[model samples]
Target: MRIKVWITSTVIATIGVAAWAHTGATGVVLERMQGMSAMGESIKTLTPMMRGQVPYDADLVRREADAMVGHSGEQMARLFPEGSGGGVSKALPSVWEDSEQFAALAEDLKTAAEGLKLSAGNGLATAQSNDSGSMMGGTTGGMMGGGASSMMGGGMMESNQVMTGEMFANMPADAAFTMVAQTCSACHQKFRKEDE
Candidate 1:
């Protein structure tokens, strides 16, 4: 009787663990997915404008960049609590194990989004001056600002007026957007499962 009782208790405990893992983990997976989805939607909104397929609208870029910034940084890191990576989660083990790296990537995303917003609202020069090349892969001052100055014949790009659609279409601001996208891709490649 004692042996039978022990076996029954073991089975019950195993079932309990499974249920706990499944139910508890589902909420975290859903939350993180929702946050990521919002970021993706923002990227989709900006791409057409960057490509000149649609009219360039700085206000629209600022709005979407703000949304991207909102979804990133500490807000993003909070979505992945400890032990919340199993079950249906697309997040890999590295996200929790190498958490500092993950946090750095999140911060990088925020910086890129902020740069885009600054460029859209203030001017491309503001974004270039602020770039540290930490998130975007290269120095904006050297690559973007210098290049743009030469392209524009070395005069400061007018900061007060919204860029003409033609000027916006041809602007180096596209590089800023590209850097943000690349940062996202790098994080996904390192810490997210492809099947997910």
Candidate 2:
């Protein structure tokens, strides 16, 4: 009986974790959540390399960037319908209210992801050079691919716009990774609701 109880307890704990991860979300909201989770996982996989905590593998970076871009732009936005934020969703109402702006942000995300993929192929130096100035001085949209320009001080574009000079020649890959991550943060800050 003691062994049975322990097994039951373990099962319950596993179920609890699964439920918490889903957060009672359903339908399109659930789909979006799962998509976001996938993106986060891909980023997590690349973080160590980006941080130089692990050796940088150009092939791995390119593969992960492709994973991220798969869900970007129109493909990602389509998952969020007009009223899909109804069931335990973390999405804000503004998603439907200001959809055009949201669409633009999605495009920016796509651009950033594409740029990262290309940059990884080109070498860390090239990626750092292309992304540095744009991350700092570009519009807020450039960062988040969501329309929260105010959060970032102003609107910015995606990392696709290259900086052609000696300015970022010495910048590191970690900085480039941070800039890319910031773009995701910018949108989440504006569009996602904090857990209660």
Candidate 3:
């Protein structure tokens, strides 16, 4: 009777631990999914911005910026927890050890997004009025402040202007694509799986 009771107790404890681990893993997966979705939305928002098809809508820009900033703050960390199925994640173990730096990058992204929202909120007049283009210019001094300056010439255009299509009409189509690529590279370098 004693032997059977001890075995049963051990089995129950093991199951409980497994269940707890599974729950944590599930949370991590969900967080990753949410981050991916937010990133996708941010890209979508950039489409019109890149084209300069519409005048800068401060409210719309702010909302998109808010989403991106929120994702950086809330979801980036959760996606890289230890033991989560890596799937497409490029996150490295160094993220845990160098959490402060990782978080700082995330914070920088958040700050950039916030600045974008504020700049966009003030309207196109403010953006164009300033010698430096507003957030839409893709300039280093702009909201993203030129991190991916090569992606777009550092010039602020009206929201309705469709800057890339209008200004670089003759260029190969790949210019706009680099914006997304740069973002992926930045994130993958720090958080994602390093190529073996």
* The best candidate in terms of lDDT: 1
In the range 65-99, model 1's lDDT, one tens digit per residue, is 88989999999999888888766676789999999
Residue 145 lDDT (model 2) = 35
TM-score of each: 0.63, 0.65, 0.51
lDDT of 2 by residue, 95-162 (tens): 78878867767766675566566556434432434565643233323332323222223323444444
Pitting candidate 2 against candidate 3, the one with the higher lDDT is 2
User: What's the CA error at residue 154 for candidate 1, in Å?
Assistant: 26
Model 3 lDDT vs. the true structure?
Answer: 0.44
Backbone clashes in each candidate structure, one number apiece? 0, 10, 15
True-structure RMSD for candidate 3: 18.3
- Give the Å shift of residue 61 in candidate 3: 0.4
- In the range 55-86, model 3's lDDT, one tens digit per residue, is 65556766776776677644565556667645
Q: After superposition on all CA atoms, how large is the RMSD of candidate 1?
A: 18.2
Clashing pairs in 1: none
Q: What are the lDDT figures for the candidates, one per model?
A: 0.59, 0.55, 0.44
- What are the candidates' C-alpha RMSDs? 18.2, 12.4, 18.3
